[model samples]
Target: MREVEVSEITKEIAELCQEANFELGEDVINAFKDGLENDESPTAKAILEQLLENAKIAREDRVPMCQDTGFTVIFVELGQEVKLVGGDLEEAINEGVRQGYKEGYLRKSIVSHPLKRENTGDNTPAVIHTKIVPGDKIKITVAPKGGGSENMSEVRMMKPADGVEGVKDFVIERVKESGPNPCPPIVVGVGIGGTFEKCAYLAKKALLRPIGDESPHEDIAQLEKELLEEVNKLGIGPQGLGGRTTVLDVNVEIYGAHIASLPVAVNINCHAARHKETII
Candidate 1:
């Protein structure tokens, strides 16, 4: 068995939080370029250009790309063959978030309670999801989600008879209703199947996938393509001012479901699309 230090986890998470906030992945940058090239709206083209420039400036200046800086969501893949040493895993992860947000100068937006509305001071208590996998190495992904787009996300328990058309229609309407609220040129992450909360988790997890990558299953991939086409048809455009580049891409992930249940979820990410992963 392999022994991994918990301190290492803390150290990596800290760096990931800072890095994800400060940079945009190459795939996302390329998507913006492609959108700019294909979109006919002058306003959308200008917005895409500005997004590219904003990413460049964030990377060079080592500053956050968006002012929100977002809630810390950490996904951890723990290898079954590995044993953790030195400290408790959960505390280590939260410590990483606290240090990372403080040192990186990221804005602390997490509240202590839903109703009381007390500030958490430091961004501790990250929403962590851990999975047991085959190897000895641990993989951690840090995704910072802003409130605006998150507020626009939804979950619907659809009838199995409603089928794929029902799923597609719901997604399109959700985006249309969202309009500019979630910030335009958004990445749509759709999770179909699973239970109520599971599908919601799946939707959020789907956003971690790199933009432009399609589902391995042909049928699922086709659904993603169709959803993207229908969403762009909305003409919500960049920043929702009106244009053809409203949706950058649609990502879908599915799980097996029971006979009666067909749960669907849509998680939206703004133009920033900030997430970073590290394996240690």
Candidate 2:
């Protein structure tokens, strides 16, 4: 069995937190570039260009792409063969978030309460999702989800008979309703099957996937392609102005559900889909 130090996890989480906020991933940048070239609307193309430029500057200067640095969302893939030493895993992750936000000059966006909201000054207590996998390496992915796109997300329980078409229609409808709100052209993550909450979790988890990658399942892959084409055709181009590309891509993730249920969830990522990952 492999023994790993919790302090290392903390440090890695801290760096991942800052890096995710500060830099746009390569796949995302390429998607924007492709959007700019393919977009027919002059206004939309210009907006995409600005976004590209902003990404370049952020990376060059080591600064966040957006002012709202977002809530630190961490996905941990722990190895069953490894044992954690030094501290509680969750606490270590939070400490990493605290230090990263403070050190990186990233904004603190988490709050203490929903109804009576108050800001958490240091952005501590990250939203951590841990899963045990058969391996010896611990993989961590940190994605800072901003409010703009996240607020526009939706969840629904469609009848099992609705099938693939049902999910496609629901997602496209949600994007249409959310036009210009979630900061198009955006990346749409569709979670199919699973329980209601599990569907939502999978949808959010799909956002952590590197942009431009297609779903592994052939059926889902076709759905993603169809959805991507349809969403871009909405003319809700960059920043909501009319254009040929409203969405950069659609990523669908599926899991098993009950015979009677088909839970669908939509998680949207803005043009600035900031994420970074590390293994330790």
Candidate 3:
């Protein structure tokens, strides 16, 4: 078995938090460029250009692409053959987030409580999801999810009879209702099947997939394509000014569910899709 130190995890998470906030992924940049090329409206094209410029400036200046640095969401894949030492795993992760946000100059957006709202001061207590696997290597992914897009996300319990068409309709309606709130030219992550909570988690996880990558399943991939086409047809366009680039990509992740339940969740991400992954 391989031994991994908690200090290492903390150090990496700290760096990743800053990196993700500063460096926009190439896939996202390409999506915006493609959107600009295909968009018919001059206003939409201009908006896409500005988004691209913002990403470039963020990278060069080592600054956040968006003002909202977002809630730190960490995905960890722990290997059964590995051992962690030096500190509490969760605390290490939270410490990393604290240092990352503070040292990197990213905004501290986490609140200590829901109703009795107060800033957590350092963006501590990151939302961490851990999965056990067979290998000795651990994979860590940092995704900074902003509130504008996240607030627009939703889950619905649909009748089994609703089927694929109903699912498609629900997703489209949600996007329509969201309009420009989630920031248009968005990436839509749709999770179908599983329980309500599982479906929501699946949808959020789906956003981690690289933009334009299709699901391994052919039917699911086709559905993603259909959703993308239909969503763009809505003419919400870039920043909802009415154009042809309402969505950059549509990703659907599915899982097996009970015979009676058909739960679906939609997670939206704005053009500034920020995530970084490292394996150690």
Stretches of model 1 off by over 4 angstroms after superposition: none
Model 2 residue 202 CA deviation in Å: 1.0
Q: How accurate is candidate 1 locally (lDDT)?
A: 0.93
Query: Which pairs of residues have clashing backbones in candidate 3?
Result: none
Q: Which candidate is the best by lDDT?
A: 1
Model 2 shows how many backbone clashes?
0
Clash number by candidate, in order: 0, 0, 0
Candidate 3 on 1-280: residue-level lDDT in tens?
Answer: 8999999999999999999999999998998888888888999999999998999899999999998989899999999999999989999999999989988899999889988989989997799999999999999999999999999999999999999999999999989999999988898999999999999999999999998899999999999999989998999998889899888888999999999999999999987788999999
Clashes in model 1: which pairs? none
Candidate 3 wrongly placed segments (more than 4 Å)? none
User: Each candidate's TM vs. the true structure?
Assistant: 0.98, 0.98, 0.99
Q: In the order shown, what is each candidate's alpha-carbon RMSD?
A: 0.8, 1.0, 0.7
Determine the C-alpha RMSD for candidate 3 after optimal superposition of all C-alphas: 0.7
Arranged by TM-score with the best first, the candidates are: 3, 1, 2
Candidate 1: worst 10 consecutive residues by lDDT?
A: 117-126
lDDT of each: 0.93, 0.88, 0.92
